[model samples]
Target: MHVDVIPVGAGHITQDIARGLLTPVDHAERLKTYYGAAMQSPTDDREMIDVPQLGETGPAEDITSQLPRSVLTGVIQPRIEETLELVRDYLEAGGFDGIGARRVVLTGGGAQMPGIRELAQTILGKQVRIGRPCRVVGLADATAGPAFATCTGLLLYDQMAPLELSDERQTEAKEQPKGRLARMGRWFKENF
Candidate 1:
């Protein structure tokens, strides 16, 4: 019997950005992709961004919505911090508190943010690094990023699992004896 399950991935940095910016999700998403970071650095403050407006009398070429990079930093920082706090709470409540000193890998789309490694390490008290797909032969360039690491890992694991041991375990489980009395009970019940 086969069952389909959706695995939950960690983090929602984009959604947090979307809510904080008071912009449509699509526009907010582009802002986050182009300019989002865990904090504002000196270099970031020098940049200005033009974003799409979702307001009525629609988007016009001359009326582009503009904001300083620092404003973006301000908007996203609290939300990212709150998200990190929730991640900490989740790990602790799930009895993973001992991982404090271990190295944690941040993968997937949000890991591409400029300061995520430093931010995660600061908040989670663990060494954090960005992880991308590795050891995949003939992997297309498009799917070789951090976002694809999980699926690549699953594929790799499926290829490498020790099948004989798994088969032995399954055989042993299926053939377990019910014992003489239990077998007799089943026999009597079936016959009756």
Candidate 2:
């Protein structure tokens, strides 16, 4: 139930795009941001994208245009599928019992990709939707997406949270009999 961290976050998809496309991390990331999709579409074959291929050793200067949208899909889709599968396992262990989530809400920057919800639905067998932050008064539109949900939520909660008594107050109210022998003697006296 405590599957906290695995190789399944938005960054993994970026890394996959970089390694799989043999592009520099920067360019791969740019391509991913600009063009990456979770599934293949009709335009995938026709449209082209410039993938940075560092030729031989140091070809950062060369900067050649390469590959199509489908290549990005080929690399990105598998990684997405793999990450979700691991997530499925984690969910199953964490009391889901393989029934899967009725509705999967994807958050963060990764969820912004094209066709992501559909891809998640296909692999996870659930209705998928992109989640954004709401119900917070005066929250900035820029910081209102899934990427900032947890943080914004905490901040909002903190503002509205009620104060409670601390442990020190409760302990201060009780009598503190110090030594172990004294405590045992008091217990015996009370019981006897």
Candidate 3:
């Protein structure tokens, strides 16, 4: 199996806020809350986000700014399309173009945003689904969504034992003469 990854995170939204609103963010955590609430729906309506002022002398006042939906359509959506296009180009160059036809699973906090899956589907021309953490034991209900998928995956991965070659494979590996090319190929096959 071959997996291609694209880095799309909540930080992109924060950057978009800074760029679009032309405001330096003081409290990122508080801004994230506003982003989460504002992106609950895929609408053209403008949202009011209370952003903390950064370069203040004495007291800091919250800057109430109107967040236009263009942030989603103009900046965020274009970035997603560009990333997917890059992935498609990479797969094509590697002769794995057919892999692009498979369904896309959008994971992490950005996947929970409204209309993100639909936007991805439209861009990639493939079925898209928001991926949530699965088979997580004792996972709290609040953390069972796509936002916690990365954490759950890390926990699951940490619990897994390292893969060991079988006795037969170990014997075959030892019997083969270790040339530089052979060693390089073995390293690639093992890691990749």
Candidate 4:
């Protein structure tokens, strides 16, 4: 169970908007919701997003502006490529030698974006699948997509207790090599 965590996330889209937009938009929370919907089915055409009370002092008025799809795709696609590249580098570096290394399971809000699976497969030259919570009980269908994966995983993790080693096992662990591989193995054992 060798795992590599990449830091790129949905928040990056909001950051990109702040930097890439011609006119500054200060409402990140609203923008996240707006852009998140747009990302679900991205296209080449520009979109109009309406923001209410866009000004600081004037009476409430909705501001409609054009948001180019390139803004979202430009930020997202490259990050996905970068993530796959990192995984490739890890495999080449001999950090991950697990079974089914060529198969990638993408989970999280970003995974639901249209074309992401195809893009990842093309970039990684591997099979990629959107991950969902499996073997979960009492999970609503509405909340069962990749967006809720982290939360479901956390709930599952909460039920797990730390492994307790016996004196003999502790002695054997103490004798193991203190290296990167050893640490990773120990972590895998502890968590999984």
Query: Which regions in candidate 3 have their CA more than 4 angstroms from the true location?
Result: 26-33, 36-53, 57-61, 67-73, 93-96, 157-162, 166-192
> All models: lDDT?
0.70, 0.76, 0.62, 0.63
lDDT value, candidate 1, whole model: 0.70
Count clashes in each candidate, considering only residues at least 3 apart in sequence or on different chains: 0, 0, 0, 0
Q: Model 3, 14-113: lDDT tens per residue?
A: 6765565555654444454345432235454465445445565545454444455444345455555566576557656765557545776767776766
Report the Cα lDDT for residue 26, model 1.
74
Q: Where's the lowest-lDDT run of ten residues in candidate 2? A: 1-10
The 10-residue segment with the lowest total lDDT in model 3: 31-40
lDDT of 2 at 141: 76
How far residue 77's Cα lies from its native spot in candidate 2, in Å, is: 0.3
The lowest-lDDT stretch of 10 consecutive residues in candidate 1 is 1-10
Q: Candidate 2 lDDT, tens digit per residue, 42-94?
A: 98999998776855455663676668889889898888888878766776677
TM-scores for all candidates: the values are: 0.71, 0.73, 0.62, 0.61
lDDT of 1 by residue, 103-190 (tens): 6677777678788788888998977778788767888888888788778978887898955568778887478567899778777887
> Which one wins on lDDT?
2
Model 4 / residue 102 / CA error / Å: 1.9
Q: Which segments of candidate 1 are over 4 A away from where they belong? A: 1-12, 58-62, 99-101, 163-192
Model 3 per-residue lDDT at 170: 91
Please list the residue runs of candidate 2 whose C-alpha ends up more than 4 Å from where it truly belongs after superposition: 1-7, 55-62, 97-101, 135-139, 163-192
Query: By descending TM-score, how would the candidates be arranged?
Result: 2, 1, 3, 4
The C-alpha RMSD in Å for every predicted model, in order, reads 8.9, 9.4, 7.9, 9.3
